[model samples]
Target: MKKFKKFLIWLVGIILVVLIAGAAYLHFSAYQPSTAANQAVKVAAEDNQETFFKAKQNKLTVIFYPGALVTPNSYAIWAKKVAQAGYTVKIVHFPLNMAFFKVKAADKVVNSNENYVVGGHSLGGAMAARYAHQSDNPHLKGIFFLGAYPDEKGRLDQKKLDVLSITASRDGVLNWSKYRQGKKYLPKTTEYYQIKGGNHGGFGSYGQQKGDRKATISNGRQQTIIAKKLIAWLRKIK
Candidate 1:
């Protein structure tokens, strides 16, 4: 019995060590923002407020969450494009660069008086859906996802929220089986799009992801397509 107890203790210690090592890797190996994304627009940062691209009129607001281990600035190019097209955009930074660390991070930046849409990429998108499912914000007009899907807990189908889900045809990082299963959680009216020749990393200005498939399209082309589709959707909402 003493020997068995010693083995159990050893196993527990090994597991804890592995968990800590993985967390450290995630924290240190986060994706870096591209130079073009950095130069595309001047992001506004305020104390305790989310980093944002502010439009002159602020006709609409979009609060975006970054993917796991992705730096918030990696999304600057996309946000800048959207903001120039006439909507205010804010990218919420997650603790330890993971949206799962704080699923309700968007709550800090959502303005009650402004019409807004909430969305995220990969894990971030899933968390955003979870937040929208539970939030009672009257100004939240839509939910957007980039290579991400809602989990069962979101109850979006029952709530019948306006949702847009965009995925790359060659995305290798996203689990197809899980994505298919999660589709049931979305409302019947959800609009879904598959960007041909695109890959998972094309949604942001971050360099290629470790396990993602090679994108046949240029990053610029992919982002432009995303911007056009998103702008069209925003116009409809407005």
Candidate 2:
């Protein structure tokens, strides 16, 4: 018993050390928002601090999460366009820019009385799916993913929620095998779309990622497609 306890303690200690070291590395190496992109935008929140793009008059809201190590501002430019299309868009900024730190962070931004959908980009998308599947919030009408998918344990196969998944044709950064495996976790009504010639990093304003392929389309062009898809999806749900 003593030997087993000691081994367990050592194992936990090693895991914590690795997590801390990885977080520290991400803190310094995280991708920053492009300076060329507009930095000024409307900020609105009841309790949570976030970047919000609110339509003058709107009923439904779409809460977005940033990808791991990505700045919330990276998504601001395109979010404004989506907001202009009608629905309110709120981008949640997570601690260390990692949604894994707070999978339920959207809870603070969500207004249960109002209609809403949740989605995220990359790691953020995966976490958003987990939040949508785990929460009993009836107002959560649907979810969307940008180069992301749900995890095995966070499956939404039995849920009635609408799901949309957006992927890039030239996205080398996404794990194709894992994404394929994750489809079994989505609901039967999930919709999938791909942006031709776009790379993974084009989903946000951030410059090229280390492993991502060079995008054939400009970032603005790719983001426009993403905004169109989101706007269309929101219209369908409402």
Candidate 3:
């Protein structure tokens, strides 16, 4: 009995030491400054570009929701890209990760705009879909989901599904089985794009985590590519 107790104590001590060391390393690692506070900053587009933002004031509006526990600032760059592509972009922040909380916040920002395209990163994408599906807005353009899955419903409305776009990669946090099951509720024409080399957490709007610079660079490249494609897709529809 005494020997067993000693063994357990040694195991606990080893685990504690490892955890402390890892925490220290991560804290001291290369960390990028967060630009999350600049959520309202819009990116400038090319001259003579036929984007939705320039076409008319009543043009389609695209709203971006950040991932779980993330701020809208993380998706600012991506939102600006879409805005540049001609869609008026708005990034809505939820008080918490709950969609119920986000829905009310987003409602204030929508203001009866008919042509709205709602999208999000990770769990935020799921929240956006839930809002659009449950709302009475017929003018909603479409939904773009990034690294997220449709909720319990095997169905999103046909109108929204017609314009749905699912962008995910192997590294993303999607449960393919659950995602596939939800597809039954979506429009048969919904587009799906698999982002290569992307992770479920890394593709989020938030900036890179404090870690190896190489990993950060790789994730940044993938995210940039995803953002560009999103802008292109939004422009084509606008």
Q: What TM-score against the true fold does each predicted structure earn?
A: 0.88, 0.87, 0.67
Better of 1 and 2 by lDDT: 2
Candidate 1 overall lDDT versus native: 0.86
- Per-residue lDDT of model 1, residues 205-233, tens digit only: 88899999999999888989898888888
Candidate 2 segments whose C-alpha is farther than 4 A from its true place? 1-24, 39-48
What are the per-residue Cα lDDT tens digits for candidate 2 across 1-238? 9999999999999999999998799888888877644553434332345788887788679899989888887887678888888889889978888999899988887676988999999999999988988989888899999999899757899988999999999999999999999999998889999999999888898899889999999998998999999888888895
On TM-score, the leading prediction is 1
Candidate that would win on lDDT: 2
TM-score of 1: 0.88
Candidates 2 and 3 compared by lDDT, better number: 2
Ranking by TM-score: 1, 2, 3
Model 1, position 27: C-alpha lDDT score = 84
Segments of candidate 1 deviating more than 4 angstroms: 1-24, 41-43, 46-49
Tell me how far the alpha carbon of residue 109 in candidate 2 is from the true structure, in angstroms, after superposition. 1.1
Question: What are the per-residue Cα lDDT tens digits for candidate 3 across 1-238?
Answer: 9999999999999999999986566444422224542432434232211111232343577766666655445555555555555667666645443344555445666657456777776667777777777766766667887766667542474654344454445443466677777666667777777766565555544454332122323545665776687766766564
Off by over 4 Å in 3: 1-58, 205-217
Clashes of each: 0, 0, 4
Alpha-carbon RMSD, each predicted model: 3.6, 4.1, 9.8
